[model samples]
Target: MNTPKENTYTCLIVEDEPISQEILEVYIQDCPQLLLKGVCNDAIEANTILLNQKIDLLFLDINMPKLNGIEWLKSLDEVPEVIFTTAYPEYAVEGFDLNALDYLLKPFSFNRFLKAVNKFTGLQKNLAISDLSSDLTITVKSNKKTYLMKTSELNFIESDGDYLKLYRDEDCIVIHETLKAFQSKLPQNNFLRVHRSFIINLKKIDYLEGNQVCIANQMIPVAVSYREGLKELL
Candidate 1:
């Protein structure tokens, strides 16, 4: 028999309809790996919870009173992984465009809900897998000189339009690389791209003063989109 799964994730339901909320609650309750944290009739209540607590998944509805789900998503500085629940199919493209885990139509079956949960879990597994690299030394070709550097010796990475600034404790290298492509080669657990233009080694955090991450003597700006992911580390 398979081992019993632990309830490691906290989930929130953001549906206003009574029947829909009850159904979604039942579906969530049956899952061994999910813990229902709260239910919000509107985005305001949900936003309060998000600020005070950490949510792993958000079951969000498109149509709601006062504040709609899409609008709520836009207003959030840091958002949990979301699965959009809607009666209308027209908003599917927009939901997926915002990187929602799944879009569930009205009267969705328990199996369908479970599939969306599985998709979220699968993504978590992939991120964990990427952190399995045991390589110590990092080799990068910059111009005519091939640089061989130890992974632990690096401090942070900064994007300079078409080039990247690889910062070490003693020296920094300006290489012809984009932050996105160069970030892929970095160890996931040790380094994170906290902003569009900056990636920092998690171990090097001096302090977190508001939205700024202090590494060494430099203060790095943490973009709203990437702040939640960094919170998991802090």
Candidate 2:
């Protein structure tokens, strides 16, 4: 089993064919954003793993022994993000109807595989934003006071030693927390860590040039390692 990297999504591949499974395993291993949790020969084996573990992404083959992929997926009450893999293009229409992320016809290239994975990443980035309610707020504790802060009002956060400064328009609030710890509280769709010491709300960006981002008149430096991810969101 491959160990998952930090901030990686867990993936499960359900394909009966040894050749198809090998191809998918290779493609998944090459993608840093995805971690293969398990590979199942059929939907029955996949179902057992799904019941016992949390799978974020599923690459399910349309045809299998005992239970076919399409029938198995429909039987699930809570389905994960799915991408259908099959030789038959005839199943494409039905797969999309079930809201699968992408349908990959057999003998697909690595580039095609990447395109499907990118679709999943794009959907994940926008999922929270689409689901966000206007009244959504975060409960924050600073000093002895507990404040309810609107997520929409927040601009950016700056890490200062062991403390963090959360900026909201003209107001700033100091909290006793690490940037990484505070990051889990915010929606991953909008909030992004651009630097080791800075996490900015993508919606609140005034202007971004090179490695510098201006959020509510405050300049935040974007680290080189995080530039690619920030660019993707922007």
Best by lDDT: 2
Clashes of 2: 0
Which pairs in model 2 have colliding backbones? none
Where's the lowest-lDDT run of ten residues in candidate 2? 127-136
Best by TM-score: 1
> What would the per-residue lDDT of candidate 2 be over residues 157-194, giving only the tens digit for each residue?
99999999989876899999988889888878878999
Q: What is the model-wide C-alpha lDDT for candidate 2?
A: 0.91
List where candidate 2 sits over 4 angstroms from the true fold: 128-234
Question: Per-residue lDDT for 77 in model 2?
Answer: 91
TM accuracy, model 2: 0.58
For model 1, what is the error of residue 232's alpha carbon versus the real structure, in angstroms, after optimal superposition?
24
RMSD of 2: 13.9
